[model samples]
Target: MVSRPHLPEDRMLVEQLRLQLGNIGSSVIPTILLALLLVWVISNDSNAFAMRAWCGITILFKLYLAWDARRLLASEISPERARRLLRRKMVINAIDGATWGSLAWAALGTTTVAGSVLVVAVLAGVAGSSMSSLAPILPVFIVFGAAELVVLGAKLWLMGDPAYDALAVAAVLYTAALLGQARNASRAARRAIGLRFENLELIERLRVETEHAQAAHRAADEANLAKSRFLAAASHDLRQPIHAQGLFLEVLARSQLSADQHDALANARATWQASAEMLDTLLDFSRIEAGVVEPQMQVFPLQPLLNKIENELAPQADAKGIVYRSRETHAAVRSDPALVALILRNLVSNAIRYTEQGGVLVACRARGEQVLLEVWDTGIGIEPAQHQAIFREFHQLGNAERDRRKGLGLGLAIAQGLARALGQPLSLVSTPGRGSVFRVALPAARAGVVAEGAADAMPGPSRAFDLRVLVIDDDESVRTGMRQLLGAWGCVCDLADSIEEAQALARAHRPALVISDYRLRELRTGAEAIAALRAEYGADLPALLITGDTAPQRLREARATGVPLLHKPVLPSQLHRAMSAVLMGRELDSSFAGLEARRA
Candidate 1:
C-alpha cells in the first residue's frame, strides 16, 4: 500500500492536483489511438475477438477518465478535496497502468516475438510520457509506475527462460529510475510555485509602503503651506504697530532732550532696529520660499558692486577692529545685479560678524567663462562635516546661545537661496581652526556686452522737501506718525484712510508724491489708490507702495503694479532714500531694491 503525498502547503496541493487533472483530456484521443494500434499488431485469427474486446475496454476507460477530469477541473477545489481527489487519481492511474500491463501477458502468451517487442515498446513510451502530468504528486506516479512494472515483470518471469528473467529485472530497474525522476520533478514544481507566492507577497508590501510615503509627502506640503499663511498674517499685524512706533520715534528724536533722555532714546531706537532686522530676515526667507523673488538679469561691471559692499559693510568690520578689504575686478558678469549684491552683502556681513581679529576679503577672479566671486574670512572656521548644515535656515555655528547681535542664522541660507534662484552655484571650502572661503560661480558676460555706469548710491542726507505728499493708510496711529515725520522733514502732507478719501485729497492738494499702504479698508489695495491718484494728477506722477505682507500671493500681486514697494517698520533714513529716488525718477535705493527687483 503506497502512502499519499503529504503536501503541507494547501495552495501547492491544490495547484498540483489542478495541473495533473487539467492534462487528462489531451491524452484521451492519443490513448485510444495507441490502443487500437496495439490490437492490430498483436491480434491473430484465433485471438482477434479477444484483442478487439480489450481495445474497446481501453478506449472506454480513457473516455471515462477524461470525463471525470473535466468534472473535477470545472469547479474550485479546496485543499482537503484535492487530497481526496489525489488518492482517487492514484487508484485510477493504477487501474490504467494495470490495464496496459494486461496487454503484455496477452501478447506474449499467443503472439510471436515481434508482437511482444511491440507491446514492450508501447508500454515504455506510455510510462515515460505520463511523467510530466502525473509527477507533481510523487505518490501517484510511484504507485502508477509500480502497478504497471509489477504486472509486466511477473509476466516476463513466468515465461521460464533466462532472457525473459533478465528483461523482468531490467523493467524493475527502469521503474525505479522513473520514480526518482518523478521526485525531482515534484520538487522543481514546488520550488517554482513557492517563489511565485513570495514575489507576490513582496510586491504587496512595496505597494503599501509606497502609498504611506505618498500620503506623508502630501501631509508635509499642506503643513508647510499652512505655516506660510500663518506667518504672513502675524507679520502684517505686528508690522502695523511697529511701523507706527518707528515713525513716532523718528519724530521724537528731532526734539530737544537732556543727555540721559537722549541716551535712553538711542537705546530704545537700537532695540527697535534689532526687532526690525529679524522681521526683515523672516520676510526675505518667506519671499524665497513663496517663489516670489524674481531675478532681474543684466550685464554689469563687478568693481562698482564690490566697492558698494565695501563702503556699506566695512564700517561693521572696522567697529570690530578687523580690517575689511575688497579686491577691484573689471570682469563683468551676466546676472541679477541686485540679487547678486544681496548675496555678497549677506556673505560679507556674515564674515564681518564672525571674524574677531583677522580681516575679511571680498575677491573675484575669472575662471574660463565664469567668475569666482569669493568671500574669504579669517573667522572661527567650520568643521568639514557641518559644511552643508550651515546653509539650512536658522542653523548657526559657534552661536549656540543664539546671540541676536551676531545676527540671525538666515544670512547664508538667504544667500544660497538667491544663488540657486539665479542659477549660480555657491560652494564652501573650510577647515576647522582655520579660515573658510565661500565662492559663487557667476557666468561671465561676453566682451563689450557690459556697459559701465555710475552705480546708484544711497542719498547723502535727509533733504527738506517743499513738495506736497499724499499718505494713505487705514491705521490712525500710522497716519499721525507719518504726518509728524513728514512735517519735520518740511513736506506738506495730506493723509487718507481710503481710496475715495485719497482721491478727494489729491483733487484738493494735487500732491507731488503718492505713498499708500498695500492693504486698506473696504478691500481696496494701495495699488488701486495709487492708480486713482495718478489718474487725477497724471500718469507721470511719482508713486510708492508700502506693505508688510509676507504672503506669496500678495507679494506677487503688489510687485506686478510696477511700483516701488517697501516693507513696514521702515527706518526713517530708508524712507527718505525711497522718497528721493521716486522724486528724481532714479532707481530706488538698496534699502528696498530687493522688492524693486521683484517688479523687474
Candidate 2:
C-alpha cells in the first residue's frame, strides 16, 4: 500500500483509543470463558483449587479492564487523556496475558499430555483471533502478545525434555508471525481513518465554494435590476426637455427668421434628432423585452422598403465619403415591413459608421422559400469570436471610448430582437480586417398570399383643422410647447397640467381631439387621464398617449391601454400624422404605424 503522511498527533491518539476500547468488550467475555475451560482441561485433583483460584483472579482482572473501557468511552477523550487511558489498558492487558501464560507453567507437568496439548492449542487460538480486535494501537497489541509468548517460552525452556525445548522455539517463531500480521492490520486501519478525514475536508471546501457562487449570482442580478431602473428614470427625465424643445422648434420654424438663424435652428434640430433616435432605440429594446412587439405579417414588395432605407441612411454614408448602394430587386417577401426596415437601417448605418474608406451595399437574394436580405460592408470588420457578442445590448466593437455619435451600442441588439420576434433568422459572417455580411432570412412571399401595395405618396399641405384640441402634460414647458405647436396648425389648444384640470377643460371646451402625456402628477398615469376624459366625453373621443418611459413594465402598461401611444420627443411631422389619423377616424397613418412597430 502507498503511504501517506502521518495524521496529527492529537487526532491519531484519540482515534486509536476509540478503536482499542470499542473492541475490549468482545475480548473480555471470551477471555474469561477460556480461562474456566483451561481449568477444567488441565487441573488435577490437588491443583484444581489452585487452578480455580488463578481462574478467579483472571476473571477479576478481565472485568476490571472491561469496566475501564466503558468508563473511557463515556468520558470526553482529549489527546492527553487518551494517551493515559491507552497506556493503562496496555498494562492491564499485559498482566492478563502473563496470567494466562502462568497457566501453561502450572498445567504442563501436572496434567496428561493430551490436556497439555489442549492448553497450547487454546493459547494459539486466542493469539490468532486477537489480530483483528487489538491491532489498532500496535504497541498495546505488541505488549500483550509478547508478555504471554515470552512467559510461555521461558517456562517451556526450563523443562529437561528435548520435545519441550522444541515447543519453546516454536512459540518464539509464532510470536514473530502474529506481530507481523498485527502491524499490517494496524496500518490498514490508520490509512482508512486518514482517507475519511480527507473526504470530509473536500466536502466542506465544496460547500464554501457553492455558497460564494450563489452570492455572486445574486449580486449580478441585483446590479442588472439597478441598471434597468436607472435607465428608465434617466430616459424619462431626459426626454421631457427634448420633447418640449422639438415642439418649440417646430413652432419656431413657422416664424420669420434670417438665413443664418435658420441654419442654427437646423443644427439644433439635427442635434435633437440624434438624441431622439438614441432614446427610440432604447424604447424599441424595452418594447421587445415587454413582448409588446407583434409583427404585422403581410406580403410586400421588398424594393420599396430597401429604397426607403437607402433614402434615409444614404446621407450618413455620403457624409463619410463612402458610396452606399442597393441592388434593386422586384422580388416580394412576407414579413413586418416596419420591423424589417428597422433591421436593415441598423445594419446599413452600422456599416457606414465603421467603414473608414470603403462603401456599404444592401441587397437581397433568393434562397429557396426564403429571401436573404444581405448587408455587405467594407467596414473595420468584426472578428469571428465577436460575432455573437456584437448582437448583445451595449456591446460594441472598436468603440471603447463610447462615442455617442457612433450610436448607442443597441442597434444590432434591437435588430436581432425584432428578427426573433418576427420568427425570422439573422446571421453574420465577417473577417477581422476585410469586410462583413449580415444576412436576415425572410420568408418569401408564398403562393395565394395577396401582396399589399408598396408605393410612396406625399401628403398634401396641412390645412386649418379649426378643431379644439385638449393637451395634458405635467411639465409647464411641454404644455406651452404643445399649445404653440397646435396653434401653428390652426387648431385651438386647451392645455392642462393635471388630470382634474384636463377633465375640467374637456367639459368646458368639448375638445375634438385629446392629447395627453402618459405619466402625470400624483403618480397617476396619462392612461388614467385619458380614461377620465373619455368617460367625461364619450368612448368615441379620439385620444393619443405620449410617454417618455422606456421601462419594460411601463411599455407593457402603456400598450395595454388600447389608446394609440406615441413616445415623447415625437417630431412635429410624426405628431401631426398621429393626430391626423385620429381625427380622420383611420388606423394611424402607415408612417405612424411603422414608427410604432419600430418602437415595439
lDDT of each: 0.84, 0.83
Clashing pairs in 2: 518-526
Count of backbone clashes, every candidate in sequence: 0, 1
State residue 211's C-alpha deviation in candidate 2, in Å.
Answer: 2.1
Q: Listing every candidate in turn, what is its Cα RMSD in Å to the true structure after a full C-alpha superposition? A: 5.3, 4.3
- Residue by residue across 14-79, what tens digits does model 2's lDDT show? 987888888889888788878888887678886787788888988898798788889888988998
Query: What TM-score do all the candidates reach, one by one?
Result: 0.81, 0.84
Q: Write the per-residue lDDT of candidate 1 for residues 200-268, one digit (tens) a residue.
A: 767998999999999999998898788788888988998998899999999989999999999999998
Best by TM-score: 2
Stretches of candidate 2 off by over 4 Å are: 1-7, 12-89, 92-129, 151-168, 448-466, 536-538, 583-600
For model 1, the stretches where C-alpha displacement exceeds 4 angstroms are: 1-8, 11-92, 95-115, 154-165, 297-304, 311-334, 352-359, 398-403, 444-456, 460-470, 489-513, 520-524, 528-542, 580-600
